[model samples]
Target: MPFQLPDALATSDDKPALSLLRRYYGDAVTSAGAAAGAAFDGWDSTGTRTADVDRFTADDLLAITFLSVRVPPRAAAVLLRDRAAELGDLLAELGPDRDLVGEDEPLTDDCWPGWRLQTALRDIPGIDTTTATKLIARKRPRLRPIWDKVVAKVTGTHKHQWEPVRVALREQHHALHERLVHLHGAAGLSAAVTPLRVFDVIAWREGKDRGW
Candidate 1:
């Protein structure tokens, strides 16, 4: 089943979940966007080690671990510290390129730079498919989509591997990106929120609400 945004939510028809999410977390999303934009800008201007790590502090990683996926803080800390350098290098490679797929090109595990990052992150002691992708997406928002059980179930890509999800995203990159941008504008989300993040939020929200 190909993923489709529900028309009710698309039009902002006061769906309970969508409305609640917007009311409760809209400000947080806006703040996150601001932080992310500043972080990226700092990285571009000065090659500081902190910038290299996507300006993520230990607190940020811990918050992401617990709030985003309910992972244990201790485990998340170990993974973050151990793979700090590798994560930095991966973000540096992705840079500002949002389009990682080529037209008429076959999508493979090694086709996009994200694949290498995902593979490496997945090998960490406490990381799994969702956590690995989320970590990278936090750093390279434009280039990667955060994945989890909800996203996989909603997208109907039963396997939690990055390859299939990446292929699907690449195929619909243009239209999907456009939709996200439109949604962002309509919702009055901060300009700093990347289209990929908007897309992830919408999918995640819909999936969670509908029990996918």
Candidate 2:
């Protein structure tokens, strides 16, 4: 109801989106061979996707979604045109919470209309505990599990079956997020990983038993 994810990796769309990110952005995980400013985001909504610019790849959903929403007037013509400048401004605003979304344009949902974590993951603000904990491996260049319909296109009984894995990674991500906070401070990080964005990430990894 609120949001969901599949228990297992059932979505083929993930590969396309992820591949697009890896091919174009090369790497979003800086410490893990990814470029410093590279990102691995994509969109799978019923919305149409446009070509990206030289600066950024439009194939990935992040650019597609951002550009689509930010400026739909000429979506077909221009995407990621001023992406670098926009990303720079956003990074300055979100910094530590950079992964949440495009920085200042804080993401929200019916639950967290303001800058707060979801109720389930609120206990761990700036980081959605329930969502991040699922299938998240404990390692550097750690990917904060993102969300989309691919994950929930169907209903799986073993929602979040990777709780053990999630639990293991939760502590690490928490520590890392905290470390980032200490390094960057709360305002930027918290503002960056808004509830909706984080929720989307979590929801993207949903299943039948997911609401845990």
Candidate 3:
């Protein structure tokens, strides 16, 4: 069951998402957060030790900082010490190549591991829901969709986001996914930016416009 995109997502001539992408991530080389996100993904390349599914590096925290979120020393210590193994276990359960648009519906069987990890990350002292999701998305860009307060407000997904976001991406035979890819190229964004991130920015921008 695909999500019926609201009027706010007038995918016709307006192309609000594409415009936002262009405004924020120009040519992928000179935008505000573009360099940071690209740098982070470059560092998190496949086959690297830092790219290991089970653990996070100081670089990961540093990367999110570029996007305006930070994990303080105390929370970082907690993640490194108390949560690494558990997070790794959950990551191992999920497919490395699975994209959000292709996730199984009801989402229970396939997405449960991620949900468990998300819950655990949010439980950390200094990590809120937005920070937790951003951290998870950084590691599994293809598999995890980010949801900050603004994005949640715009999408109206709030505390429950996975199913609705998945449905939106799956809508019209994966129209949103195609739009994201097109916007990435059209906006001249780096390949490092995933489709999920494109959607996140779009929703986030819309939320900001609405003063959320």
Candidate 3, residues 19-73, lDDT tens digits: the string is 6665655544554454344454445424464456567767678778766789988
Rank by lDDT (best first):
3, 1, 2
Best by lDDT: 3
Deviating ranges (above 4 Å) for candidate 1:
1-24, 27-50, 53-59, 70-81, 97-107, 159-173
lDDT of each: 0.55, 0.29, 0.71
lDDT of 1 by residue, 45-151 (tens): 33343444453445445435433453456656655575666666665665554543333354464746567777776776667787676666656666666777776
Location of the lowest summed lDDT over 10 successive residues in candidate 2? 132-141
Candidate 2, overall lDDT? 0.29
TM-score of each: 0.66, 0.25, 0.83
Tens digit of per-residue lDDT, candidate 2, span 64-99: 233112223343222235334543233233223223
Candidate 3 similarity to native, TM-score: 0.83
> Of the pair 2 and 3, which is ahead by lDDT?
3
TM-score (C-alpha, index-matched) for candidate 2: 0.25
